[model samples]
Target: MNQTAGLAVGHYILLKDPITGNPLAGNPRKIENIDVATRTVTWGTAYAPVNVTMNAVKVLFHNAAFETFGRVDSGGYLTLADQAAPEGSPANAAWLWSDGTSRALRVRTKDGITSSLNNGGTGTVAMGDTDRTPAASVHQCGVIVTTGTLTSHRLLTLPPATDTDAYGKWIDNTCTGAFSVVVRQSTGATVSVPNGAKAYVWLDSRGVTKLM
Candidate 1:
C-alpha cells in the first residue's frame, strides 16, 4: 500500500525523460554507472551529465513506517517498545511493553487529571478533608464494598473541629450486614455507648483488585 524512492547521488532520475521534459510514467530513464577512478558521473544517453550531488535533489514518498514505533506498529501509538522495562519481570505484572518490563500502575501524563483504570469490582476514592462540606455539599465521601456484609463498616463522627467544616482522612472497615455506626467513649478504663442513636460508617477500599 506504500511506494518509496531514494537516490544514491550522481544518478539520473528514474521517472523523468530529459529530452522532452515529460514524465517517464511508462518509459525508462538510463543512469550510467559511476566511474570510480575519475570521480565523475557519465551519461550513456544523448543528454549531458546532470551533475547531481548530495542534497541536489529532494526525495519524495510516503513513509508510513517512519512514525511507527520501532517499525512495530504501522499505526502511530505508544507501545511497550516505546518505554523502558522494569527491573525484574514479576508474576503480577500485566500490560507488557516491548522493552520487556512491567508496571503495577502507570500514569501516562503529568497534566491529566483523572485515573482511568478502575479497581476490578469496587473501591474507595476519598477527597481531602479540607474540601468536605456537610449540607449535601456534593463532595460526599464513601467506600465501595464488594464482599462480606456491610454492617461491619463503621463511620465515626467527623472529628471535632476547632475550625468550621474540618475533616480527617481516617476511615474504618470492620462491620456486618445493613446496620448503623456507634460512637464510643472511654470512662477511665471502661468504654460505653449511649442508647438508641444511629451512626454513620466510614468508607474504605475492599482490596478486591490486584492492580500490579
Candidate 2:
C-alpha cells in the first residue's frame, strides 16, 4: 500500500461507497499513521491497509474559524458561540463565534477583563462602579471593590436569575467586616460575601433559588 501525497497523520479521509457512490457508513476515518518508506497508511483500527490514492478518497480540511465538532451550515461552518448554561449539569463555558457581523469576541466580567488581552487583567484592577444588567445570552461575574477606607460597606447586586442554571462569581474586597460585601439576586435571596473571599454562585433551576 503506497501513501498518497499531502496526506498526513490526523487527517480525516472519507471512504466512498463503491455501489452507491456516496460516503460509506461512518465514512470519515482519521489517519492514524503514515509510513512513506513502507508505503503504508493506517486509519486507526477501523480501516484496513490500502494503497493511498489521493483521487480515490476525499479529505476534510480544517476550518480556522470553527472548532472541532461545530455546527455546519449552508454558508460553510458555524463556530461555537455562547451556549445556554445547563441546569444541574456540567457544561462547556461560553465561547466566541462569528455571525458575519461582529468579528470581535468580547467576554467581560465585572472588572475590565476584555477579550483583547485574552481575559487577563494584567495586574490592573477595575472598580465596581457600575451595576451590571442581566441578559439571556451573557453570563455575568461580579467582584466587589472597596475604595478609600473600607469602613463603610459596599453592596453588589446581580441580575435576576431568569435563565436556568445561571452562574457567576463574587469576590469580596472589603477588608473590615465579614458582611461588608453583599450580593442580592433577583429571587430575593441575599448573601454576604466574606472579606477577601470569592464565592461561586449559581441558580438551581429545580428550586428556583440561588446557591453559593
Candidate 3:
C-alpha cells in the first residue's frame, strides 16, 4: 500500500486527568510546524491558560529616559541648577532670563548691578539670573547693574494707595515720581535707611517699609 495513503489519523494527548486515566484536552491546542532539517513536525502550547508567544522582542539597555524624576508636588515647583558664564565674560555681562527666554544681560558702564524683587500686577518677575559657586546664590532679585564702581542700579518700587504722607516724601526726592518709589543702595545694604532697599511698598504703616 502507498505509505501516504496508509497513514492513519493520530491523536495527541496533552495533560493527564488526575483521577481518571484519560488524556485531557482543550489546552495545548492544535498547532503545527514543519522542521526542514529533520523533516519532522513539532508543536507546543503555553504552560498556563494565558498563552504568550515571543518572536521579535528587542531589549535596549541604557536607552531609557527618566520621566518625572523631580516631579513637583501639589504645592511645589520644579527647580533649576545654578549656572555661570565662562572665564573672561564681561563682569558686567551676565545671563538673564526675561520671561521664559534667556539672553545676554549687561548693565551700564556707570551702573553696577541692581537686582530687585518686585511684584507686578501679574505677581511675577520678568528677568532673573543666578551665580552658584563657593558662594551659591539661590536667587537674586532686582537689576544686576554691574557697570562701574556701583554694584546695582536704582531699585524703584510703587507704593499702594496708603501711606499718603510717606508716599509724598518719595515723590519729592526728584528721584521718586509718578506712582513709583526708588530704593537706591550702596552695597547689599540700603542706601540710607536700614533694610530700605527699593521695592513697590504695599503694607500698613505698622509693618516695615514694604518692598514691592
Best by lDDT: 2
Arranged by lDDT with the best first, the candidates are 2, 1, 3
lDDT of each: 0.30, 0.46, 0.28
lDDT of 3 at 138: 10
Better of 1 and 2 by lDDT: 2
**Cα lDDT of model 1 by residue, 65-89, tens digit:** 2332344356775443354533343
**Where does the lowest 10-residue lDDT sum fall in candidate 1?**
184-193
lDDT of 2 by residue, 1-212 (tens): 44468888777776664556677555466677887887666774233534444444444443223234357588996655543322232133333333334444344333333332123311112224433332322224243333223444554545555455465554534445433455566555666555566555554332223245
**Candidate 3 or 1, higher lDDT:** 1
Tens-digit lDDT string for candidate 3 (1-212): 11122211232224444556354444323223433554332434331223223223221112223333334557786432222323344444443222223332322221133231233111222111211111001113222121111222334232222344233112111222122222332222222211222333223333324343
In every candidate, how many clashes are there?
Answer: 15, 0, 23
Runs in model 1 deviating more than 4 A are 1-56, 66-82, 85-101, 110-124, 128-212
